[model samples]
Target chain A: MRETPSLIVRYVARRAVPFIQLYALYVLGHGEDGPGGGFQGGVIFASSFVLLALAYGWGQGRKHVPEKLFDLLAPAGCLLYAGIGFVALLVGGAFLQYEAFVGEGADHATKHHAHHFGLIGIELGVMLTVTASMVILFFEMSRPDEEGAFGDGASQEDVEALHDGSAATEEAPDA
Target chain B: MEVLILAILVGLAVAAVRARDLMASVAILGGYSLMMALLWCQMNALDVGFTEAAVGAGISTVLMLAALGRIGRREVGPTRAPLLRLPLLTMQQRLRRARHLSRQHHRSSAWGAILVCVLVGGALLYGTRDIPQVGASDSPANRAGSLAEYYVTKAPEEVGPANMVTSVLGDYRGYDTMGETVVIFTAALCVLMLLRQARVRRGDERDA
Candidate 1:
């Protein structure tokens, strides 16, 4: 939080985050053709948010993504991934079977299209899970704690207590 | 070209290891990862290269820098010569006064870490001798009976993937990728539990 006091860093990060977030979406959506994938795109997405925190501190970051929402987002991503696979099982096919999604696709081209569609479904799941996880990890590690216990946030009381503890330690040398 | 890249890799690795400042070391590690990403690109593994550049060089570097904030930047000096050295940096001294730290030093621990690094590096170098030749058509990895041939020939016709890696990752090994997503979710949950703050505010009887 102390490291994020620079005006230029906040300015640059604010300007750059939108573009980074946009690229993350592009990478996730157009992943089938390029060097992008769900995991790669997700991490990139998370880093954009992480930049917000690193540049402007947890106060601004928390405003952008509430801590409670982030806690739910991570597990929701994983569940989305598993839900797609479960659909196949419910449709009388082996788990994660793409051919099961083909309802009227009687030909090879149609079948191929179905597989492509299925791949996109899982990719979305991966993107969500990875993005949520990376964001959560960043938020967790970068949190400034009160009692040196790596807590969620630092309160005024914690700061005062910290000062008191330091003062006590300082005076002990003479006593 | 490979030799040049390898030389750069070696140099970066050494630089990363020898760097005294934790922040500087993290920056060097990021550079090293970028080099590895370039090497992967040269080898035509674009997806792997992209992931390496994004995750290892980008996010991991940021994460290291963030984590470094919790701990001391300076490695406590083990040499007795610097024991009495009280740096007279006025600005820094004021900053240090504001932030309290408890430092401990062990020269043997540093030596042990160096020894471990040497052993690991040596073992890796030794293991490289047994590796099959790169890009060899006759090598076990690329032989006629190998799985690579099947994936190359059959994937397009059967799986209909624009990218073979996707075909393999999402279809042939769909379970594996899904498992990876679950792992990511689990990690998120663990971090959440660890970092979540639970506090109970007490009614002040002292004020009354």
Candidate 2:
């Protein structure tokens, strides 16, 4: 990795990252947002994490967005999405029926508000899941210790065995 | 203006193909994507342009470079190409490298596959040329009684979001968006399941 691990680069990254993350949040919240949402914002958010990983190695990188949290958040985003749909179902409407959230005979404005809320909720779910997933994929691929450990168990062991026989015990030897 | 950008894109594409260095090719590919994104923006598709800029120019280039670190960096070149002397010093060494690449991938097969891809892509582009101009108000896509018309007219009152796209995606076509979220979630789960094997094995060892 061609890492420019200097204070100046890190400082610039540190200063710029907050705005990147905030812009990602804006993309996530599309109620009155500018163009681009969910997927774009999620990738942007994930990039911030990836940048930290690259600048400071995955060791410090993993700390910024803990591995365990990423693991949970990835799936949780999808569950949140399904749960919202289930809520709509419980409200006596068809699946994903935001109109049902507004009481029957409610004013048009109320319906509009309900729809807006539902859309924002699901978009948030997308953002969370996408961001977490992208970061996870990045971490998995970028891990210095774990080359060719991406597939099933058998292949991973074969790769490890091959590495052990040929090269130095190079990849995160202690860890 | 569009023609100028397209001409630059064509030049970039040719340069990307001719660039012997894997990393250089990837960089040129990034430049091509930027031009494409610019074209999208010029055509007033800000949302599509934003996505292209973010994904194409941002994470993809970084990821490709990172991947290049794992897989070999400089592509193996043939002996006849004296220009490749930077990496291949001797004829024997270049031939050996050429044989290695041929073993993995036949050069002719690669060219044939690329030709097929270009042919199919051209055909598809030609087929789609007759479709009404993108976002044209009077196009059949936006005519009354169509779903697009319904969303545009009724989305605000019914779905509530001022944006028709969001309303259709999150409210009208809510199930699809939910599924999309689940798919993204599942992607994370799959990565964890596959990549976190060491932790899982440790748990199993303790149980055993």
Candidate 3:
């Protein structure tokens, strides 16, 4: 409701986002060795953006992560994922076959090496897609339009209609 | 420990359901997700627990708050229900009004719904008895030569990932993960389209 949250919230959120993002990357990169992976990491990463948005207001948050960048990254991750699969196919193996990334050595070390890198690449792709998608979702959903509940263009009747005609009266004096 | 978490989860569920304020309901739902995440960790599914904590508790709560910002937080209901008016009435009048209000307000249907939910829940609880206990080696899933057995035995050797869960998810079950990613992408795009279209329409109306 307020243009920006209180100073404490803004400061805490600003300070926390970088650490949250770093943790998300740790979860993503450590997926193969630990208990987290792309989805969890990506959500954690997006939560940083969401936290910033809540603290700084949507306009300032949008500036941090622009629409054009979100659009580019959203599809890019999915493409990267699919591209890995296609590359496996091109290497003359089944779809999504990580073993194909390495040539036909059939040795244990080569297979293991290929699978390791392949999983990392795939998780990275997944992380990118998930992160971009979630950030955009928060941005789009929270972006105040002219007809929103507290938007400037909303008439008294429209606001009343949205809030069952009683709640707006309770908060009107504050606004 | 699991029992404690599950109890808290049930309490949170009831609190979320019975909350009069939508904002309170969202907060209660977040608590429920956090409890569920703890339960998942207790069950040794750390990835799922992490996801439940992040997506269920963190992201969804923020999204709901954003949505509440757009639409008012109050649930759409009668501002002045008969129950609230009872303070002015005498004892007998209050009793009569309470009975009348209950019948008028589909109280019987609510009771029926509660009854149905109890029956369905009991059935589900009964059905769980037939399920194999956790990590039961004789179970169909863990039986020798089954796909699970193969994955458990060979995942590290085959995929070179110490975490079998990631190896399975990223490689063996790669298609499913890809589909999930696409679904998320599509869902975001859908929301974007709907919200953008509404904004555009409003802008056009202002221009007109």
Candidate 4:
């Protein structure tokens, strides 16, 4: 079996994923003030995962970030978003009306607090959904079948062994 | 200034369509979309601009690249010579000879291009007719109760979000936004399904 790529590439990608994820969070959090938003930030963050998959291998990438989790999280994020609106409706306000959540507060501070809560909840949901969707898309696109399996253009059997090895590890006894 | 921008947009669009290379065409199309987005921003259609920037500049380019990956990159050479010419042909001659031959070889492609251009141009013209006057304060959007005012003034306070557009999309008109999200999800699901690996049976049918 041939060796993987340089440790430097893996190390760089490993280091970069966190920073990229952090930037995505910043973009999502500050979307109201900046050009970057949930969608763009999500794709940018997902690019790191694609880079990681390229640097390492798909099996390792999938092990690190499972496809099933992404599939679940994508819809879950949207559900959380809609659930917020449902909460607003339950509060006797119109659909998605945050004002009802504010109550009859006298002070401006109280009103601002309520508003922040609602916005944060929604933005977080958007970020989760967008990021998951993008990562899933990358996975779907770059996934190897019979042709073009490894990063170094390796044989299909090697890729299959790698995949099966990862699957076996996933099913292994806990330490 | 508007005319200059429009001219640039038209030129970029022509270049996008006329480019021989698929990747070059896709890149030019992205530029054309971005220019059109800038024009939308200049026109104060911020929502439209946002949608166009995201869908046109981003998603469309990505989709085109994915398509290029599936389809080989090599461009087909142009045909050798022009085939047909009709100076004062009768309807029967036109239908039987010109139209039928065109449908088989080349004429349909040109006709399809012309038809698409005409349809798109007509739609743009029709939409422009109904659009509110540029920078008019009394436009329908402006007069729609306190929505615009809320976006300007109370947006930050109400949503605790500095970006009014984000607040509006994620909170105020969230239902419509949810629908848009669903549309994206559906599209993604469809693409995934269509492209998913198909299982080949052991005793499959005979080869063609």
Candidate 5:
């Protein structure tokens, strides 16, 4: 009935999760300069949460990062993205046309300011959407079934015991 | 050269369809898409090639894997010719009718008809002498006053991003990208809603 994972395994998982999230952020931030982008980076970042849930159990991860928060943030991110484009439209240019944001002056400084503002806004929107979606997906996938309702909000120890029991059954039959 | 490329494309497509293993078929499809992307690049359609790379190779492969995970991996049986049972007709009459048909006609009557049509269509394409040569600088895509010129010249200055295509897609065509994102969001929401177990309301308790 021993449920807890070994100290070594727990230690490794705890350390690894933060690094994975950081890497995802790096990928998202540098997406324009590199091969990676919002979609790929978001998936990778979300996977870190999935890994955390797998290793430490879903309850702990959910306690740390709630699904409801991501649910709200996901749409908010989309709205933020759309809002930027709407701003451009209101400025007398076509939707998302940055030239309209620039003042009446024909100089490069005006153009550069508009371009910088537009790119930053779009990147922020992408980052928000990607992070929220990934976390939400992981939560949905790892939610407990009715049969395991007894183990709902179960600790990491309980999950380890279940995993070990299944592993033992498979190994015992072969041996 | 174009003929050789077309022949290879045909062979790859056939292999993708006929492969017995689902994983193998998926791999073949990936190869087919990669080849098609390369062909696009060679034809000087870089934008199309970029899109094919992103959607065909990246998204499609992930989707296929996700689907395979949900479905069982093993192939059930060797793919047989679809059974065509004429319930009212006698077996003898069916045999007689099948024998009376020519082999070419029989083959063309089945799914292979589509293949034959495609091959004939390709042959007909060879007769279009007025068609511009591939990657011709004077082609409409490269002609004066074309959109490509504007994209090449103004995109970097206007968007402040070195990647002109990304700028055009994310900024210049932001509305379209926003719509596409909404479509993706809707699809994701639909999948989540359909697959999710119905929630039990408070006070509606039943012991398992």
Candidate 6:
């Protein structure tokens, strides 16, 4: 494949990403009333970045959402989830009891609101983690081997040796 | 509707298996997922349908494409021999064809895989005989005082989400979701360590 796809592909990808992201947000927020939630939303969101990678290059996609951002967002989502659970526990309720986000004396309506908010918060956490992980996987897996330090040791001779089995070793046998 | 989608799914599956080009196989698999998502929608499992569309069809296709970019797309193997021969072949030609057929690799393994698939599919179909049809009120899980009955009846009032799946997943099964989130995060961390460690070692070698 070419390093950069054709102009038509790039133009369409650039135009489509924002709409895809907006729809992902809709899916994430509208889960209670509709057919999507964190996992689906996050995958859709990540796909926008994947589109960018396909049209441009892996380096270009990584430029938009860098590895540094991945390191931050990945853990931040898990922390948010654990923090919500601990908040309920610290207030003398079950670990993830959503009603505990409100005071013990709060009325049913307030507790209902709290529970709704808590579910949204959890979903947000899921979206962040999933989105980061997917982008990370894409960038890592599609990375050009030439740019990697791990490939430095793989010389032409090493490849030939593996294929032809004809290179005689100079080193002595193991002691 | 279900039958149409299922037929398309089976066709896509066979096409994916028979395709020699890895890229075409990935595309066919994506179509299979699309048909599967439609099947889920037909069964009234909208959330599962959404997941199948996004994860199975969309993200997985992109991921496989990325992997394909890393590895060459053409599969390295012996070219398939033609399945037909003229009925009036000479004795020498017949012997040569027989020798060629014997030289083909993986024919036995292919038969073994087909046998395994048939046995497993038959066993699963046989096992489904005991299960009730969808939405049967008297089914084990749907009967009075059962957990599903309790969740369907009381979850909305108690958990405050009109969507029972949301309420159940986010509240009743909060720990499970949390654990899943942690597991995903852990996977990212492991990838980071494995990929980054090599770069860090290279840096140390540079310093030396």
TM-score of each: 0.78, 0.76, 0.86, 0.68, 0.62, 0.83
- The prediction achieving the highest lDDT against the true structure is 3
Per-residue CA lDDT of candidate 5, range A47-115, in tens?
676566656765766776775677777777678878888888898877776767875675887786787
Question: Poorest 10 consecutive residues of model 4 chain A by lDDT?
Answer: A149-158
- Whole-model lDDT values for every prediction: 0.77, 0.74, 0.83, 0.67, 0.63, 0.80
Which interface RMSD does candidate 3 score? 3.6
Rate residue B113 of model 5 by lDDT.
Answer: 82
Which candidate leads the pack in DockQ?
3
Each model's iRMS: 5.5, 6.5, 3.6, 8.0, 7.2, 6.0
What iRMS does model 4 reach? Answer: 8.0
Docking verdict class for candidate 6: acceptable
- Per-residue lDDT of A60 in model 6: 78
For model 4, residues A1-175, the per-residue Cα lDDT tens digits are: 1355699988998899889778767766777675556665665566667667767876677777876787787787778778888898898777766666866654677766666677667666666676677666656655554444323344443455466446544644551
DockQ for candidate 5, C-alpha atoms:
0.15
Task: Assign candidate 4 its CAPRI class.
Answer: incorrect
Q: What lDDT tens digits, residue by residue, belong to model 4 across residues B79-169?
A: 2111122444567866676556566678768889999999999999999998988757888777757468658887777566666777777
- The list of candidate 4 runs beyond 4 A from truth reads A1-17, A51-64, A90-94, A102-107, A148-175, B1-5, B40-60, B75-130, B143-150, B153-160, B197-208
How many clashes show up per model?
0, 0, 0, 1, 0, 0
Model 3 C-alpha lDDT versus the unseen true structure: 0.83
Judged by TM-score relative to the true structure, which candidate is superior, 2 or 6?
Answer: 6
Weakest lDDT window of 10 consecutive positions for candidate 3 chain A? A150-159
The 10-residue segment with the lowest total lDDT in model 2 chain B: B79-88
When summed lDDT is taken over every stretch of 10 residues in candidate 1 chain B, the lowest stretch is B79-88
Stronger candidate by DockQ (1 vs 2): 1
Off by over 4 Å in 2: A1-4, A31-33, A146-175, B77-129, B135-139, B198-208
